[model samples]
Target: MLFGSDPGQAEFDEFVRSRAQALSRTAYLLTGDAHLAEDLLQQALLSAAKAWHRIEGHPEPYVRRILYTQNISWWRRRRFAETPLDAHEATTAAPETGDRDLRLSLEQALAQLTLKQRTILVLRYFEDLTEAQTADMLGLHVGTVKSTGRKALDRLRALAPHLEELIND
Candidate 1:
């Protein structure tokens, strides 16, 4: 069990069952790739399980810290260099609806963002964390959080201008 006795194991399992999907979605936001997100979530959960004894009372923060910090570490070590299909190959794939196309465009735009900008956007908007909370989580000043969030949003807008219609809708 986490940071405690046998009772803590039950609590930890319950927490995982209830929050796994939500946490996975957060991980997906941090990492654009669904496969990587699953791996990231699994690793974070294993790390949390190991420290259950110490973080028994509050495991969420510890797990989230692992998710964020380790994601950065992994990206740094691996250059995020994914190969792209040529236009001919891409267009030859199964046709998608407008909604799917829009989602893909947004995802591509998100991928284009710098790590800092992408992280800030995901932490602030996708995770619905306050600037203060994001600042604390990322170990940045609140001012830095605000500025980065603003800049990230601006860049996202510039990258996917067509999303404005969907946003309004």
Candidate 2:
């Protein structure tokens, strides 16, 4: 119903509610700022709502495409003003365990990545999207997604060697 009075609105709303947490997590990873993530999520939801009538069989892909496009647009508009979280700010939240520290380190390392690289990583890891899915969502070639993912992983490894251990565990 929240998706509008279209035939697929109920199903779409169910899908949105089910995927909201995971999508928010991916958005947080993409933007690194909670506020921006919220904004991105809202924008994506609005766009998805508008298209719900036409996105019956594959709403997930439609919503993901909107989210990715909106994220890239947001990045382009804010590219100049964007800045990485400072070390102090990054560590401000007390980690519950070594694993959390590892996660924080990875987040910090993610902040160092170019926006595109960060986006690719978020789509790949946080969203659990395959390379082809990511490429489709981002309107890029599969090879580009693969290469970007490789480079992003390399940068993460270089920045936080501990992440490998954390990931493995």
Best by TM-score: 2
Superposed by TM-score, candidate 2 places the C-alpha of residue 51 at a distance from the truth, in angstroms, of 1.4
Identify the leading candidate in terms of lDDT. Answer: 2
Q: Write one digit per residue (lDDT tens) for candidate 2, span 1-169.
A: 4544566777767887898887787777887778988898888888888776766686766766677888888878877887654444444343345766667777777877777889988788777889888898788899998897888787666666656764431
Per-candidate TM vs. native?
0.72, 0.74
Candidate 2 achieves a global lDDT of 0.75
The per-model lDDT (C-alpha) reads: 0.75, 0.75
Clashing pairs in 1: 2-52, 2-53, 3-52, 3-53, 3-54, 4-53
Candidate 2: C-alpha RMSD after superposition: 3.9
lDDT of 1 by residue, 48-115 (tens): 88877788566787888889887777766664664333333322233256987977876776776666
Q: Candidate 1: deviation at residue 127, Å?
A: 1.7
